[model samples]
Target: MPATPASDDLREGSGARALLRLATPVVASRLGIMAMGLVDTVVVGRYSSAELGYHALAWAVTGVVLTTGLGLLSGVQVMTSQAIGEGREADTGAILRRGLVYAGWIALAAALFLAVTGGPMLHAFGLSAGLADGATPVLQVQAVSLIPIIVADAGLFWLEAHGRAVPGMLAMWAANVVNLIVNLWLVPGGNFLGVDGAVASGWATFASRLFLLVLLAWIILSWRRARELGVLTPAPRAPHAAQAMRRVGYGAAASYFIESLAFSAMAIFAGWISITAVAVWAVVINVAAVVFMVPLGLSVATSVLVGRAYGARDQVGMLQSAGQGFAFTTAVLLAVSVGVWLFPEGIAAAYSRDAVVIAGIASAMILSSLFFVADGLQVVAAQSLRARSDIVAPTATHLFSYVVVMMPLAWWLGVRQGGGVDGLIWAIVIASTLSAVLLWGRFAWLARRPLVPLAQPRAA
Candidate 1:
């Protein structure tokens, strides 16, 4: 028999070093992406609140529709991590090649649809003349970048899949460096590009990030160890490879739509209160984006750990991975909650300085921190579910929490009850609490299996 795989070593390690080995840079990767979004808001805010809201409108719309594309990796990341655990490293390429095929269609349809419909859709949320005109072009051009983001996402998921999270983190940093440099040159005040200068900056960001991410993908793809990510060149093809890809892709798309629709609605509804309210809401949401990195990183790590355990068929290992993830997520988030509490005004100031803007945003940030703590729980649990290939249960939990319950609650707090931003905060809290309860319940049910050694495939 072939020697045991490294994945078996990880499944066995279950030590501090092993967990850190997975989490440290994965957390750094999360931070790098957060920094990039912060740079976008800070740069755009240099113009005017109206301009910032314009970019905000564009980005919020995309978040609702485009972010779901990230779900495409629910399989690649979790399943690949599991496969690697079984020492089946040589069969990954066919899936990647097929992913590119699927992502292409998704990026194109999503981009075209957004380009054609941004104005009317935005108007429904009460966009103004300056905001509407400015928002439409920014989103349309940015939509073009979505194709690259989707294509590049394959590389990102692959890195996480292989437990090499550092490369993905570096790629995001490299993209950020390029974006900051180019956007500065592109968006100087009163430039020939006008508000379109901002558009040019967004375009530059997409191009540079794509180039850097693809380059990193090439370097990593060439590793001797990474051979598993490739379908064995001479290995006989699996008969159902194409079908598996379709199944994973379609499932991811559905998950994306439901989640995005619910999250996006929060922004759309906030826009109705007042334009300034929209601006304040935008600042709060973006700041939440910065605060969210910790949990996001933890969740990705949890997913990898869960998938690896599942692959090894190690019942105890699965529970340990999830338990540690939950512990780490809560511990870190609790610390973050303090920072969010002690420095709400200071944090809001980093993104905006207008008195009305700061005051309105500060109230939301304090309350929103509570929601994210709960939100952090759900993120880790849900990703853990994805890691074990138990995708459907978590999907149902999120649907019920965000759509069935959170939406109406948000409307009540922010609108029906005249609570303003605090209302939105409570709405998120409601959804997040429900999500945590359901995910914990589901994870408990899945962790009761017996161990089985991974079966090595026969040589072709």
Candidate 2:
């Protein structure tokens, strides 16, 4: 039998501790993800900055394809979590079935896009024909494995729906270890092959993800008792669940798309300053992303919990989860911000040696640390709001914050005022703060007068 929290545990008073307990897995998962990114950049940086740039850009492009489909993972998580929260075993099964179907389609699309259309597109971006050519085979081979990665995403979401996040966390962390080992063993100096080493890294990602998928499958079989719980059926239909998922998926994707575009454009902004500026900007963004892993995980936990409450139509639970989650995210980021602000230079130096690069990155990191806190809060609040099925707010917020607010503000401050890169960094801070304030306000309003998604699958 699946373990359930004590009766009193679900009450509003216990929400914070319960949310924290829920958040632990997410924190570990996010850290695992950060470690993987850090290691990838560090190991590749050992080869050359040029190689780092090439690899980063390549990975980014590949991500654009796979990451979008992984969008369904959140959709499944939100909907399935809601199902679990409502105590509808049949609905959970139905939601999982739909999620698996969507995952499969996303995997196929990733495979084809990377194999066929991906390379020439990169070449068009001014990559040396040779470097682009060299990366193609790697991308294609890696694309074949991208499907498995999304499968892992689906598995993790399934686990999250059941409030069993540790297995998912372990699966991803294990993937990180496998990646590190493979990179050490196969990459250029380690494997004695230059371009071939990078290729090996992609294959390693594939191998690790596939392994995790199997382990996750095992967990589902054993712990879930999915069959006995009545959450597994021969066939399930959940278009309503799918629709609810897509509602958030589309919103989150919009937010993701705009944020990614803004940062990607920062590279262009750096190019205006100098080549070294690009390198510096790269380091700052990378480190920032790693730092973000902390709040990102927290935000996701909030979403799952809030999404569950939203599903249950439990207004008090929704408000408590949202409040405690936001408070937790803010507290965590405040600590992080203080540390980064105090020693931006120290942090940058740890990543790179060039004095100019270090100075720029430190300046950027210091200026941007608080910005991340705001961004973190906004992301969680916005996601929870979406889980409540108030999708228009997050959409408007993304458009208003990034496209309307940040992009224009960045140009004025960064370019018009000639604040240059630091000016651009300040723009991010401005947008993030607004996003947090606005999202929190909106969340407060929604929690007061909640909007629920589709009715709980009609009680079996």
Best by TM-score: 1
Question: Which residue pairs overlap in candidate 2's backbone?
Answer: none
Task: Please identify model 1 stretches exceeding 4 Å from their true place.
Answer: 1-12, 126-130, 189-198, 226-239, 249-252, 449-460
Task: Tell me how far the alpha carbon of residue 303 in candidate 2 is from the true structure, in angstroms, after superposition.
Answer: 1.7
Off by over 4 Å in 2: 1-13, 123-145, 190-200, 230-232, 271-273, 411-420, 450-460
What lDDT score belongs to each candidate, Candidate 1 first?
0.72, 0.72
C-alpha RMSD in Å of predicted model 1 compared with the true structure: 2.9
Candidate with best lDDT: 1
lDDT of 2 by residue, 26-137 (tens): 8888788667667766676555555555555556566566656666467777776666666664556666666777788878877887788878876775645655665566
Worst 10 residues of 1 by lDDT: 1-10
Query: What overall lDDT, based on C-alpha atoms, would model 1 receive against the true structure?
Result: 0.72
